[model samples]
Target: MPRQRTGGFHPRPTVLVAVGTDKHRFDRLIGWLDDWYAGSAARPTMVIQYGHSRPPTIPGAVPFLGHGDLQRAMATATLVVCHGGPATILEARRHGHLPIVVPRDPAHAEHVDNHQQLFARRLGAARMVALCESQAALTAALDAGLAQPRSFTVTADADVQAARLAAVARVGHIVEDLVAAAKPRRASARH
Candidate 1:
């Protein structure tokens, strides 16, 4: 016999924090979120995966989450706060959550380059994600997003869809090139 769903439905707002799997720490974003959570009047259920970043000294914060666990958390989350990586942002969108993005800064040593900042700005301009470059911006976004969560539904316009496809193709090509370069070369038989 199959198990049946038994629990009565009770809606509770949830927030998911994903800081990516980079080697460098994103303490700036973690600390800011901690402060925001502490100051908020109506606190939602918060699930955080700090990755290589230091875990916040807050009640619900955790150092890391496995892939399946992160997916499960995101599925239930009303809001997603994440580092501005293309894959992470897309994953949040795929889960029907428009993420509030804080890009890693090279100057802050959060990344080796400022590509995330540039990507976040472009995505923000396209209305795909909320860009939070500073604590004030993050706080404002959090207040608004938590009050009313937005759907990340892509429009059916052909031009927009084409543009998105092209951008994704470019990123795919870049990833392919990087992977190819990282592969070990075979030794010459004539040597």
Candidate 2:
């Protein structure tokens, strides 16, 4: 069953932190938020770490919940900030929230040197999401986003259609290949 949301337009925006496999970006976000909250008393902050290990301390931060709390918290979040994990980005999109994506760098030995940076760069370039690098950039993004939180609205259905068409094409190709393979070998075309 699809997880139920926590409900309502939250007055205080939340930062939903999801770092499924990569720890570098996760640690960076945690430390940055910890510092941000420490210096500012204007608004409340919630840090949801969906990582494997216990998230490091973030002093005076609100509701450091376990994995069970993730779906609910994400539902309620006004601004979702996550490491560049495809699953997490898709979840943010599913929740109708435009995410702040700080992709995990694989070069620093952060998650087997995968495609995080590539994906993050792509989305960031398109302005489909915010990409955060330094703590300063994150602070700016946080303030701007929380000042007024906006949801992600799907404007085009082309991609969806394209995906479906691609699937059909692949299936057709497989069928053709199968038919050709199933044919018995010709007896040297002639006796």
Candidate 3:
């Protein structure tokens, strides 16, 4: 069982590695992270949920983690390192983590296809995640990200907030129109 941290106690500059639950293994990411940690002098306290990937020899790695455990780890982590699955990315973002993402390659049998790569690329383009395509890149990203961690805060800009509200209103109107159209018309009674 993974050890649970409670109260206000948390290690500074913690790194959380979540390889996701894809049946296809993501040992590439895990192995590279392990190597990076091994080589680095300032290794922050690290915890990993390896999932289907091979468990690292590192002390803090676990084969899998429950949802609550994963969430708690994310909440306390200074840097989130993860595979490029959409749900994982979203969860990391929800926890205000700008995660270092390494999308699984289908050629390497790390995923069913290249969808994650494409999705990761889009998110990377939007500056939502730090995308790493290779072991070298992952090492560099880990170093840079750990050196200066950035949290993903909801935009404080009034213009961005207003734009989000407008988009939500538009979606609400669309849903209302769809519901109204789906209702059956009542026949008028003849005298």
TM-score-wise, the better of 1 and 3 is: 1
Encode model 1's per-residue lDDT on 1-191: one tens digit a residue. 11111222327667889997878899999899989989997588888889888888766778788878887887777788999777777667656666799999989999766778887898889887889999999999888876656442233345564467457537834753563455334233435
Q: Candidate 3 residues 29-117, lDDT tens each?
A: 87888798899876788899898888887779998889999988987887788887666776676566677889889898886557678
Worst 10 residues of 3 by lDDT: 1-10
Best by lDDT: 1
lDDT (Cα atoms) of all candidates against the true structure: 0.75, 0.60, 0.72
lDDT for each residue of candidate 2 in 3-92, tens digit (9 for 90 to 100): 223333666656666666433335566777778767765465666564643455653233235545766767667677877766566666
Give TM-scores for every candidate, taking all chains together and pairing residue i with residue i.
0.78, 0.66, 0.74
Model 1 quality (TM-score): 0.78
CA displacement after TM-score superposition, residue 144 of candidate 2 (Å):
0.7
- Superposed Cα RMSD, model 2: 10.9
Comparing candidate 2 with candidate 3, which one achieves the higher lDDT? 3
Q: What is the alpha-carbon lDDT of model 2 when measured against the actual structure?
A: 0.60
Clashes of each: 0, 0, 0
